[model samples]
Target: MWIAESVTFGGSALDRAAPLRGDAPALADLQARGRIVPLWQGKPLIANGALAWVAPGSPVLAEATAPVFLGLEDGIGWFAQDISAWVPPEAEAVQPGFLDPSLQHHPSLPADHTFTELRAVMAQLSPRHAELAATARALLGWHQSHGFCAACGAASTMVMAGWQRSCPVCGAQHYPRTDPVVIMLVTRGNRLLLGRGTGWPEGMYSCLAGFVEPGETIEAAVRREVFEETGVQVDAVRYLASQPWPFPASLMLGCLAEATSDTITLDPAELEDALWLSREDLVQVRTGLHPCVKPARQGAIAHFLIENWLADRLN
Candidate 1:
């Protein structure tokens, strides 16, 4: 739970500039001060002051760019040019290209200027330095994806300090969307139930999860998804932890469930297979010695939940 705050959207100490959300006068001041930076598709930071990711005159990668307002919600102003007309990410660009040293992306290109995605950059920066970066990255990403009106086909424009979008045609208003998905660590005494999808990397297995439907509750979604995918009945579902997955936007709700039955009748359509394994067996998978099963990646909530569960931290 301690790392929960460090998880996506949990609060990485980003300077959200919340005070400027509505104060028009202040937003204008920042625009004049030129403190704002551009975030590509709401992910990558381009430049601010002397700190820049894209080199001057480098083929303006239009495909990944979006103009975003950075500062408080009261009066944030847009500084970057609108580049939403561009298509998908450039094939040659690294995903989070800012992290690639070969490309020489910098979190603090200029000592006076700051950057976003601080959590990821924190490995090399102070917590305060990383916090501001995280704030900018998450907010910009939200604005980029929510550019279209969900209620109408009209194109929505950024408003409310980059927190709200207004449809041009029908007058519909939209906000950033955060979808909920339940990930369960099902336990039967000393053993844990882990599963693998058909297309997942070989040897990797993790918790079962699914989106919560409009009418169903979080706990019900966990139970229903588990039964539907692997025919394993679960009971005593308990909230454990949660994480934000910004790939398009989703909130992963981690939970613990007690398995009432051990036999796995996998719905092959949903998973390649599933089985109950003891802690000792899991250790092999974690260490890469298990012949058939591999553990989930380190940064994923699935891995975090499992590690904490194994350490009895969820209690």
Candidate 2:
């Protein structure tokens, strides 16, 4: 994995200013002076900005529509609000401040939000910006979806900044969780395997992927998923790369697997079609010649992995 960090959402060595989380006064002072952007779901709950490690008065206390805080891994805090508090069209305008260049507007709720499917804006984001955007989007997404404690079914309160939630009644600590998924490009000699899920539009077939079970390893997950979905037995699953898919908080683990057997027993429930495509057919699909299927999304880890594999750049 020499290019592990080269993958999308790979972290930038930002100085998160960890020591300041506990210093209320210093934190307050810094917030006042940092660059601020208003984030609104239904109502503008909070904003994020860059605070000089020394300044004061980001003045977030008064605008405090809600009390949730977002904690960066390095300890810089992002005070947050449950965007669900706001209604739909309004929630779309959340401005989280200083769009750190990730992918097109960091694919946030703001105008800058980028999506792998939205290619026009994708290039606007610098590689580092895309990484940070993915990170922020992922964190915010987790916060939005996991407001209730899983343990006692109680409404959880934000704690430990925004990095965790605590059950007020039972004291259960719920941290942000990233689901593990394995997406692999299965290959047999010069041919590759791609399949489309039941609801996918026409001819689009990307990689075979599934969630990694609680007891399974990444490699095992890759093999199991390929077999279960298309009856393609895979061996020697080699790790390729990973990415942070914030659609709902998932860590997509990418790999390359060799198909030992390919009979195409299509799982009616899992996929609508499966195929062994030669390099030539793949080119047609990529260029939109193959009318039945669409290509893997750009800016997506699946697309990147496949593109690189085709170009022989994975090494």
Candidate 3:
């Protein structure tokens, strides 16, 4: 597990500067000198394959929400802001699909910079930018969806430099939430277990995964998820690596599990299809030679784990 943090969004080594979260004067100073990444409807602004950073007073942030302090790099503060309030002039450019390919441009921003889906450009960004973008997206999305306090049912205001929400009615406080999910590489002999979720892209398959329930351990979640989806009983489960998947907010716990049973009792409610593939078959799929199966998206933990397994680097 030494390579665990080498996964995308985990090894930035950015100093979060947590102590400054509660200091108004210190935060204000950082805000004045720090660069900000603006996100539109969850998509970060990218320019030439890198995160597009602008000054705190940039005109593009006219309708932006309060900035969230991401961290520090080389003694410079990094922040992210949500400009979801601004409407794109050409709404039609925004497509509706599993992954939106459309990009949005603001009149005040550089013509070369556009708001693009993080997934589409995640692999292209440097580790530091990728971590910053992921943190920003997750934090901003949390603020948007958790505006109301759970305890008092009252609207909450952003506090702690956007790391928390405070309710004025009941004085309740809430922090950003990250759900834990187990994505396992379940193998029996030389074959791997893969499942396709309903409505996923045709032929797309990935490691079986499920959310870790309350009071459940990661190992237990991996075993239960594989059994529930493919009727495969997992015997030995071991941690592999992890990724911060902020498509809303999820921390993907990647693991390798040895399967004790191979009989697939398809759970249609959980998967559209489930099957086993030998290491050789995975080689074909990886190289795009498989006739009916597509490998998981690159940069995802599933793909990373599978690649390492193929190269015999899992040890």
lDDT: which candidate is best? 3
Candidate 3 local lDDT, 1-315, one digit each (tens) = 767787778898889999989999988888899989999999999999999899988998999999999988887888999999988987726798889999899888778899999999888889889999999999999998999989989999999999999999999989999999999999999999999999999889999999999999999999888888888899999999999999899999999999999999989999999999999999999999999899778878888899898988887
Q: Considering TM-score, where higher is better, how would the candidates rank from best to worst?
A: 3, 2, 1
For each candidate, what TM-score against the reference?
0.73, 0.75, 0.98
* 157-224 per-residue lDDT for model 2 (tens digits): 76544566889999889888989999998999888998887766556678888999998999999988
Alpha-carbon lDDT, every model? 0.64, 0.62, 0.91
Each prediction's RMSD over C-alphas, in Å, is 5.9, 6.7, 1.0
Query: How many residue pairs clash in each candidate at the backbone level?
Result: 20, 22, 0
Worst 10 residues of 1 by lDDT: 98-107
Badly placed stretches (over 4 Å) of model 3 are 91-93
Worst 10 residues of 2 by lDDT: 46-55
